[model samples]
Target: MAVLGAVGGLLAALGLLAFGLYCCYVRYIHAKYDHIPGAPRESFIFGHLPILWRMLRKQEFMHDLFLQWAEKYGPVVRLNAFHRVSLMIVSPEGVKEFLMSPQYSKDPLVYGRVFSIFGERFVGNGLVTVCNHEHWHRQRKIMDPAFNRNYLIGLMETFNEKAEELMTKLEEKADGKTEFSMLTMMSRVTMDIIAKVAFGLELNALSDDQMPLPRAVTVALEGVTKTRIPFIRYMPWKQKLIKEVKESVRLLRRVGKECLDQRREDIRNGKEVTLDILTQILKGDALEETRDDENILDNFVTFFVAGHETTANQLSFTVMALGQHPEILERLQAEVDDVLGAKRDIDYEDLGKLTYLSQVLKESLRLYPPVLGTVRWLEKEHVINGVRIPGNTMLVLSTYIMGRMERYFKAPLTFNPDRFSKDAPKPYYCYFPFSLGPRSCIGQVFAQMEAKVVMAKLLQRFEFQLVPGQSFKLVDAGTIRPLDGVMCKLKPRSCAGSCQA
Candidate 1:
């Protein structure tokens, strides 16, 4: 009995020592951002975690939650996730400093999530997710010419062709009664555009229902979003999910490999190739060090994924906002008619001429940016708005939150396209739908151009109204899109030459 008692006493002492060490470690982890303000912590171990998880589970607007925290804790709010800390910055000076400079690299852990999915390298070193600064520079330099004005202008035909296909599909249900998800329609059209224009393959997703590629891409993206939650990998019942995700990943990579190989063979055989992204990827292949076959396929998947979903969501948001605001809708339609007229194909110059449509698109992005924001990891400590940001800290620069803040936008909740008119002063750091600086989305011009073509055609051909009892809320599944998919009932436009909403 005495020996057992002594053993218990020693165990207690060891437990006390371990508890003391844990306290010290927790303090050390939190000391980095103790100075920054934030919502009151729930617990040191899971600072602000319970609230975030609750929000996620309830399908609440996580971006709005960020704005509320910013309002309570001031512009620079520090948030803790497990042992790591993330600082949310909304100030213009800080956004400029953090995003404009090359010194602040992307958070590899966050980006590295995109670098793979379920133990598979998915976007492997692609331009959008690659963290190596020098490697990204080499890839970007070679691909810049493809997105240049001359090249995008050449893509106008592909845009019009795919969008017209969508119009034909919409016509079947354009009887002024049937409700369809406009986002579903737009998603198909945009994916088709990416496949045809960027990849030189006809996806025909707009007209076909059984395209395995589209479903594979969707499943793969869902897998990417799942990877964000670290615990999902260990869920005992997720074996089937793991299999589907892996199959989806392998399917995309296998298809990408075939495309890459065929294109390479064509180039070698002296066969003509279109001026598309595949061509640019081949051109970049001249740099032998970066020309690994897997690397080439990484870009193939990267462009297809990034180039499709975001624009579809943005187009759907613009349509939703327009359906809500009749006056703005009328103005956009008038502008589209005046600029595009009865012309089947919209010229690149006419795109700039549709000024009101441009404003509407910008306004839509402000409220519902497809990509809410991006993250950066600063190399050293810095101060912004008089608050010290620690070195090696994860920073979230959220355009979605900033767009709705009263300080950044007047009457922030209202859907006002006039705010983005040419006469209206430009938002400096508060607006970045395509992001800002060197790391901005490479497909910006291509995306906007495609949007104009589709938006203009939709206005010219049909009048759309949102289905009743459907709430317009945002859903964040890797990217932010309308939760309800923007259901709409369409009527064939009676007055194509001069339609008024």
Candidate 2:
């Protein structure tokens, strides 16, 4: 009994020692970052994690909290969650230096979350999630052809076709009384377009409301967002959602594999394959010594999700913004009418003529960027906006936060597409909805072209008004989107010289 008592006493002493060491470690971590400005810590050990948890529970976007910090602390604000320290830097110089340079790779912790959703392989080593510069470069080089000028122009027909289908669907609901979710319609159209254009597979998401793919995409993306919540997979309440996300990912990859195998068989059979995204993906794989099928699927899922979700959200928010500001909507409609009067199909040249439409899209992105922000892992010590940031840190670059800052834009909260007018002084490194530099979104042009075609057509054919009492708040579900899905009532426009077809 005495020996056992002594052993228990020694264990108690060791426990106390460990607790002391942990306290010291937390203090050390906080001290290292104490110089940088940030919110007051609510917990010595947790380091603002409780505040973050509260925000998450409220379903508030994490960026909004960062925006509050940015407002208080200025351009370089420190963020601490447990042992992790991040610097949310929006200074133009910092944005340019970090995002433009390939040396600052993507943060492994952040991107690695999407690599596997609930321990199931998802977008593993895809271009967006890959941190290795060399590997991403090789994949990007192969994928470049799919987004080339000529290739994108070739996709114009697909864009027009898909957008027209959406118009048809909207026309049925254009009684001015039928309420519907514009986001749902836009998501469907974009999904159909990507599925058809990228893989030559017909998902028909626009026509088929019962399609499983759209739901899977949404669930999978929600999983991506939920992964940000620490220990979410281990949470008992989230287990159902966790299982759903894993299943969604599995479904997506299974579909991707089927498409990939069919494409490979076509190539083997000497079939003439067009330079679609899947072809580019397979070509990239062919160049490798041994093809990593998972990597190919990664790009497949990446393109499918990134290609559709961002553009769909952009369209929905643009619609939401235009609905709120009728005068802007009127001006946009006039521009669309002038540019595409009595025209069923929009030409590639026509996209440039709709300049106000371009401004509206840019403004919408500023206010409602679907992807929100990107994170970079800075290996070397750096000074940003007079703030000395230590090495081995995660640097968060937020377009959403910067675009809304008074320092960047006068009357920032005001919806003003004129902010992007031709004569207006261009925003220098402050406005990057598609991000900037070498690792910027490859499909920027492709996305914009598709957006213009859709928006222009929607404006030409229908007048939409926001449904009453719907929340305008944003939701961060992997991508930032309107929480209420931009519910709207639409009426077919009967203006002079309007295209009926």
Candidate 3:
């Protein structure tokens, strides 16, 4: 019996030893991109994950760290978090090659994380989260007509109306002493616009603070962001937040289901439904061999989340940037005054003439792009920027990092709108706020039009000042937004109705 026990103990010890060696191999020795330059590994087992976690814990702008690393480690840098390896690609050549080609698909590991939040299906196989090339292509092709030129041009009235509603809301608070969160206001307005335009439902988020959709969308995004943390579900103190997140996601799906059902009923009843986003989604589903009800809900939720939050973040950041630079704000206001001339409803032609205003918005996007970047999976080995990157590698392309790199922009930190002037050289492959290639955002034109209307009206009517002592730093939610919500005090401009620029 003693000999038998000794044999068993020896086997168990050997098994543990084997497991430990395997872990060491996976974490350290098995690194495929070690030849690529990067900061020294901060952990034997976790790689650079600890540093990332530390940055998250400290509420640091994590992208800023990536920017610093890019400067130190060149364009193609390596990063490891546990068994997963990613190469940060900031070089123009890498960007052009990987993003422009359809062969490089989205990394499932990167996008699949958002498919479900804590086991509740969030954006399940939606256009944004689907990694399969054929699937995404099918979805994108069907949805393209909804965002075509005439369709977006038709949305201008909805954009102007919702933006005007926002102007009305701001008038009540434009006392020069009342402090308000510009982000919250922008979020509400954009939510109203998207809900009405996409779903044909009046969310009225601008007038109603108690609206459920806006709050649910925010909570759902928080849930998505929290999923990035390893074992976050197992944390003791996060139970309340986790529960809230689940509930929010469920609520969003429930709303989506109800909206889809109602739209289907409307179609059956021969109701004259406009060719809106929901209609496009239903039309897409009809063309498929087998209908996917969950995928439909996935798109429903996806549009609501994507259509609203990103533009809100963009507008809020633009407001924050303009508030900080009064001279730029003055110039923008002058242009708005000259073009708009107290015209409450801005025409499509007016948008073209707001050239400086366009520059200001473009510059704001360069500095504080709401959608930072994307991830692609490289299936085969490729040499980029004089470095041989291994196949089956996950590549991270960060607009946040590239936009701030001195190699790409002159005075990377400065908020200079002239960089986007008509004569200025366009950023080759470094600047893609809406991304590039076929997978680029379909709502780019829609978003920009809505932003212009809102911003143009804001410049026309209000003179806003940044509130003192608030952190102007960004918070990297699913999309980056002003950490402080862009607190501001506003007063109606001296020439609110008309200005002789």
Each prediction's RMSD to truth: 2.6, 1.6, 1.8
Error of 1 at 143 (Å): 0.7
lDDT of 1 by residue, 297-316 (tens): 88999998889989999999
Give the local distance difference test score of model 1.
Answer: 0.87
Q: Return the TM-score for each candidate structure.
A: 0.95, 0.97, 0.97
Compared with the true structure, what per-residue lDDT tens digits does model 2 show for residues 1-501?
Answer: 999999999999999999999888877877888999999888777877898788889987777778878989977888887677888888899999998888999999889889998899989999899999999999999999999999999999999999999989998999999999999999999999999999999888888889999999999999887887877867899999999999999999999999999999999999999999999999988899997898899999999989999999999999999999999988888888887887989999999999999999999999889988788998988888888999999998999999999999999999999999999989988888888888999999999999999998899888889999997999888889899999999988887236432
RMSD of 2: 1.6
Error of 3 at 122 (Å): 0.6
Candidate 1 vs 2: which has more TM-score: 2
Relative to the true structure, how large is the alpha-carbon lDDT of every model? 0.87, 0.90, 0.90
Better of 1 and 2 by lDDT: 2
- Kindly report which residue stretches of model 3 are placed more than 4 angstroms away from their true locations once superposed: 1-15, 27-31
Superposed model 2: Cα runs more than 4 Å off:
1-9, 496-501
The lDDT, on a scale of 0 to 1, for candidate 3 is 0.90
